[model samples]
Target: MENAEPFHDTRGFFDKIGSRIGSQAPAVAHHINPTDALLLLQNYEESEQGWFWSTDAAGNLTYITEAIASVLGGGSRALLGKSMVSLFHKTAEGDAGSRTLPFILTKKMKFNSLEVKAAASQDECWLSISGRPHHDRSGNFLGFRGSGIDVTAQRRLSLDTARLAMFDSLTGLANRASMAKKLETTLTAYRQQKRTCAVMLVDLDRFKQINDTLGHPAGDALLKQVAERLLKVVGQGGEVCRLGGDEFQIMLPDCDDRGILGDLASKIIGSLSQPYSVEGNRCIIGASVGMAISPFDGLTSEDLVKSADLALYEAKGNGRGRFRFYSKDMQQSAEDRRLLEEDLRDAIAQGALELAYQPIVNAKSNIVEGFEALVRWNHPERGHISPGLFIPIAEDANLIWELGEWAIRQACADAAKWPGKARVAVNVSPIQFANDLFPGVIDAALGASGLASERLELEITEGVFMAETNETNAMFQALKGRNVRLALDDFGTGYSSLSYLQTAPFDKIKIDQSFVRGATEPGSRNGAIITAIVALAEALGMDTTAEGIETLDEFELIRNLQVSHVQGFVYSKAVSQQVLLENLEDGQWKIEPSGPAHHRNDRLSMYRKVRMIHENHVYSIVIRNLSVTGALIDGLYDVPVGTKFVIDFGEGQLALATVTRSNGSLQGIQFETRLVSDGNGGLCTSRRVSPYLIAEAGLDVPNLPAGYVPTTKIERDSLSLPAFSTVADWTPTKARPK
Candidate 1:
């Protein structure tokens, strides 16, 4: 620092300081001299309140204070010859009360608190600088004289505060407010570019169970792990966010293909449903996804989010661990579900539910060994609703315990009146098994109905063992103490652990219907899986029952595999108690296995009204039986084989088919493209006609409940003649047609 040339001589520096202080002081302070002023300035430098510097007319540093020189290292010699702009740069791009130091110096202007950073420092170093252009006595520009103070700590604190406002502290993902802002901004910009975007809403299932059982700290750890997995699947493809408390949202830009979206949703569900290790405890949870596409679903952010939320509600309602795409009818479906929840509560109060028993028969002798009790609901207006529809509804509404307890007592009373030694199996839900008082419910039901405990079997799935805590083991022991039988239901479908089988006192292992239904297919591993399960059951002294045996081939394969029992439509569907009593009036009821000789495509029978278009002529048709590959229709008469028609299922779904068979008013048609699963045990088209295209075709898209027709426009004229006669009086039978 001493080798550098000073900008001011000692005499001139003292003279300037004395003149400034004398002008500002009163007459009594005139005794202050240049030597006194120079000593005072030296004292100020030693205090280290701030630093001072000067540059020549060419912007080369000429003088620097000792404190500033030492902080910059290499003393004053290294810094004196360096350009002022090269030594420091603007601290950041944007800030209040700040300007570029280079701009201020180039313009020869006075500035206050211009923040700059050291260009050569390894660590972050900030300085708030104030400077003025100094000129010679002739008014010629000489150089810049400046003062600076360290402000690095204040800058860092401000940056940290800004980050906290936009991110979640626990998971380190974008918060709700940040996500909302991003969605709004993106949509506003993309609307002008004619682009597409998609949104997915993911909700974690059974998270509360883990949270309540293990503790909050473990739950937090599990959430962090979930965030990591989501990032793995959606890397650089979209923005994944935490919407607080087990819910997450993802924004995918420039994607509108339903096939691609569905694949992503499935991947997310599978990844999240895997087991997590939290604090040395294994935890299992599931995820449900709902997706919505751009202009097709909605144009605005609010509408898109609402559509995604409705789809999420539908996905959860159908059953957790699945994904669903938004359709126009979902709004109505959600409202209907809300109404049905109320009706279910009333049904429980009025005792309007009843039990139907499906017999589980011996594979060799064909004699009934037991019956699994299934609940049936007959709504006054809707008629026989499927159990798949209402069971999930009951669970979500907190009505499962009430409905399940009623089922146990009702099954016991019904089984007591039977005239045989046949057992009755009742399904025990995970919610019921978790309650400590559930064993007492079982004991009371057996005592009140006077049914032997040995005749009542509780069917439990793998979900009850998710936690593997003492409570689960204690519940199993308590049931066993009552001399009741326990059957592991839906085996090989979930976490099939051989370790649990050894500890759990299970009397039987019921093979899941999924494996049985496909075991007879060509080149299927299900057959080998079934064989291994049977061998394992035999070794463990547990009886095995194969479920869903609907064909002779399946039944024969199961029998040859040495399965102890069989339960499915091959013997019979669930029958009412009165019918069961009539069959069991004589001791030892036996039946022969009678069903289709070969397995064919499983079709669902319905009387739904649809549209069939042939050569621009639209005709109303009623679907008799529907399957993924084809359907039977009753409307057009005398339609010859090989006639092509487009069938319109409502809500933008369309299928192209050709008539394969014709018999009177019935015509069987085969679809050109196979349908996909709708995630609710139903078939739907893989893609739908967008509403944007429908609007361009001169139709009110919002008011119509159907899709577009690609054929020439229909024009009613006097010369037009119908190709096929219409059957106006045809009606289906009261029973579902075969």
Candidate 2:
């Protein structure tokens, strides 16, 4: 470009190039005129739609058409000898891919429609280049001659398409495809390296309620907020992705320690479940996480994902806002779940479900101030099923509304039969609170039962206050207008525990049971928490109830905190309707504080029926309380101190024991072996008669048979039974009449 004369037109450029070439190769191209060929080639190079370029064997530009030079925005001489690779550099590779334009060119491969960017240009310009290797007649490589077109607009479009394929449109998180590919790659590599990876599948609880109430646009905003929080939590070590709707998947590589994984899951749940402010409206939701680890829970992507999903279902099934791990035994059969659902539906419809009232007593006078109505289901065949197991089922099957309506009607009717001063409290689920017909349901129940609204208290968790929408506000106002009291239940378990106190209309705050159980242990913060809760309640002019008060120390600490009411075994367990009414009629509803002065390890206040065996005689007894080390028993009259016996905690949990203290009908026995978790929130002995052993003994069923005979010889003959002093009777001082 520097040495050649400028071409006035295509004809001049052709004649100049033709005359020079003809001088060097007059015999080579005698068949055609070089001047005519140069004219046609120059004409082709001058088109605006395309540009022509050529580089020597070293890949530096030897020539570029004048039109491309103008597009590059410089004189033709400046770009003629620059490196072609330096001018239009290839960009970073696409996601998870290895092929790049630079690499392709280095291989000397012919390529078409390859995209490159103008690295030296000031403007962001993309180009599509097509090139092929050139060779002289001697077959020695000369350089590359290529044609390129400006693909700036087309490049943007292609990039946008790639982004959409990899990212969620709503939250801008990695889409399912991206997550799947990453998980597969991670698992495959980690398996060979023996490194661990954890997968957590998070499903938002009560998300549908928000979606239906606030509409989809608000839901989208809420999701974006959730995504932002997750990104903050996950940070650098892992990836967070949206798996459509309100479900999310998190991939953590090189992490399999369940403690750390559990902590992360808990943090995610807490963060995501916090109240969301979307479009100026407050929305609340919760998350349940299920986690699985590679090389243990599963080995492949599909298996691991399925395991995590199952764990998530269990977490939600156990209770919302919880996390569960994948265990081998968690493979629940579909038929069993179906049968359970059908039975639950039948139980609700046929009045097999009943409510038990646990008294909330005034701390000073121990008078029955209120009763928390807890639902129970007697499966008739499976015996008494726990509310923990059934409540979640009712929620999942959309049977909560029906069960809730029944609870209200039944509670009101039962409350009518109680003393006029006694009040009844019932729990309200998020669905029940959000339903438009809930107010009418309450009104009808109150009217039909002739129960005063003042005697009915509705207990709600902080989660119900998540939505500050107009409709949600109206519902609250409507309930308050009925003159019924509102109690904030499980107060300190949620995020923003203090925020709800400012706006939520609550007459009472129930300190969550989790905080009450360990208030006495060394360095336990729960005692201080109780004190703070009581002080806050006083400031807000609201009463506070300390729940799960099982020991004398807990009660004293709670009373010191100035908690107004106490609801737990230290007062009274939920009793039958007949028991409640009889006590009310007899004027014996007042309970006196009675339990161990100091909390012991692994104590549980379980009132259940068990068997006491002494000297080969089996006697039925009532276990008033139990612990890992011992139990307080009744129904055995005048049992002597140090009497050797076997305490038969049901399900073949036989504990070898010696009575340490005997007082009237009650005796304290210490177990020789500690109990272990039954995997269902209860405890059992370390060993049990296996079902196979039961059948081998010719039992009628695979259970401890009545009038049983032990095949193993008794060892009590050689053991020493300690003779200890009789301890003083420890019933409630008031009930004992001094």
Candidate 3:
């Protein structure tokens, strides 16, 4: 041991190793034996691993190991006494550098491994490290001591496994499983925070068609392009996942407002509408999207997904290429409709339906000219449900023919009690007309009621004749041959034209009430339309009835248009058969014309009173056969001289005249300056006054035969009262008898 040079060199090497270890060791381990630490370091360097050491208060290398550097490279000597920075090559400064070392020291991390270039050879090396804070048994902190190993190959293998599990190889998007997990986590957080979010389920509208027509590879390429576009649209806050072939799902975590989802859906539709070049061929594809929101459409992930799927179905049903939101009412209505459809099939068998008649009246006469048979249902449990609710159900169930036949028979039976003049207007459903037995059903109904076929009017909408084929035309002709009047109900509502009226052979066109109700407004479109319709019908030799004429003004308007008939609530609502019969028997069946002829012989009739004074011979007479235009003064006797007379007309109208001569029992007088007033301050126009002149000599006043009627009849019979000239030869003279 005395002054051995090899021993000194060995001690120097050990001391240098200790100094390097001292620099890196945590302070809490400094008090450990240096020899023991050296042994530990030697053992670590010999093994295929790495370790770091630190000093204690005695300035000894309390912790030492060199296994990590040996594993990272080839030898521990390359790492011994090298600063922690030296493990990194110059080219890999970002992986291991002063910046990272400071972070490790300040964090007091036990260890960390990073890939870096070796300072000695400038070659890349992978290192794995672990570190823990050095502390005494009492937990007094000193410094950090750690160990590390290089595991770059192991890391690469793990990364490959993760990529295979979470991503789609073709689209490079998160797979369904990963997306589901992410959605579940996000939904949980959203539920806890009471926040809103939206999930969009997107299904390509015609991906299968593309795959069929083009090729599967082309379809796959299109899907990849679609994924890229979706991601571009969704941006960072949202996640897009490929659920399966041609189906993608998007989860927008913080999207509380559904309007954003709508916007996104629109974008998706627009983007998909553009042609995509796939495998050198341009391909067009469409997409349908369904969106479900948190706490509105659903409360959980499953509920949301299910609701979205249902909405997607709805979108597809609505011709696809659109988006729909999940609505509880929609689902409920669909379910209700299904149940009602099933019940409707049985309802017909159970006779739950009935028909009631509402009177369609003549506007002028206020008489029920026809009955509009409206169907009603007396549901066993629901009691008196409207036909609007159940008739649609029957139609959907394909039970319309049965229901329509029943309604026809019931209406016919009810109409028989009404006046024979009154028509029974049975509404024919469009669905019933699709069957070949429609005409036969009408025949059966008329036969059952024993009612005259002429009294039955079949009412159908204008749409019935639209797109009419030869078969439909033949059916109509057969019905018409049985004396049934065909009325196009709700005319002017749908595709109404003069050509239809001419071609359909309709007996009448019922103008819809929308026009009739507004008819009173002068210069209104309704007035013009109604007038045109009436004119058209007249031109076609068809009767036109205005429906929904509820007001007196509307009645007047329709009457002015000369519409044949009108019906509305103004007359009465639908009633039972007994009520209708009673109403008919109550003598309310008078047909009043729409004019002033209702009161006969009540117009003003006038007769003239005449008086004559001839040289102290006073004569009194009366005029007969007075009309609005002229009169005749008859009962007068002969007078010896010319006399002035005044004649009084009713309503304070009078005239003055002079008797030029007389016959045996009559005298003729000339109207002298026709009086302007009738002595009662009422102005008399010339049209109400007439004049006469004497045309014969005097008659014997004393020897006049009693009660002798005039033999010669003048056009103006009043002129024969005396010797009067006809108004045709009479002329006005400017003179007053003095």
Please tell me which predicted candidate would have the highest TM-score against the true structure.
1
Worst 10-residue lDDT window for candidate 2 reads: 721-730
- Candidate 2, residues 1-738, lDDT tens digits: the string is 223223334355456568767776657534567767786677677666777676777677666767767667565567766667777554565621223555655677788877676765687887778889877667777777788888888878888899999999899999999999999998888756767788989899888878887889998899999999999988897999999999999999988655577668878888987778898887878898988777566778898999898888777777778887776556763335567789999988888889999999999888888898999888878888877777888898999999999999999999898864789999999889988999999999999999999899999887776776777678888999999999989888886557667767789999998898777888999888788889998999999998888889889888888899999888788998888998898544889988778766765777788877665456677888877788888776566787888887654457898889988878898888776543234456655444334445444432222454445554556644422212243343423211
Question: What is candidate 3's lDDT per residue for 298-334, written digit by digit as tens?
Answer: 7678888988887775565454667777655458756
The C-alpha lDDT values of all candidates are 0.84, 0.78, 0.63
lDDT of 1 at 320: 79
TM-scores for every predicted model: 0.87, 0.75, 0.39
Q: Residue 82's C-alpha lDDT in candidate 3?
A: 38
Question: Which window of ten consecutive residues has the lowest lDDT sum in model 1?
Answer: 729-738
Residue 118 lDDT, candidate 1, scale 0-100? 73
Error of 3 at 478 (Å): 1.4
Name the regions of candidate 2 deviating beyond 4 angstroms. 1-48, 54-63, 70-73, 90-115, 130-146, 193-195, 333-335, 497-500, 586-588, 601-738
Q: What does candidate 2 score on TM?
A: 0.75
Q: By the TM-score metric, which is better: model 2 or model 3?
A: 2
Which is superior by lDDT, 2 or 3?
2
RMSD of every prediction: 5.2, 10.8, 32.6
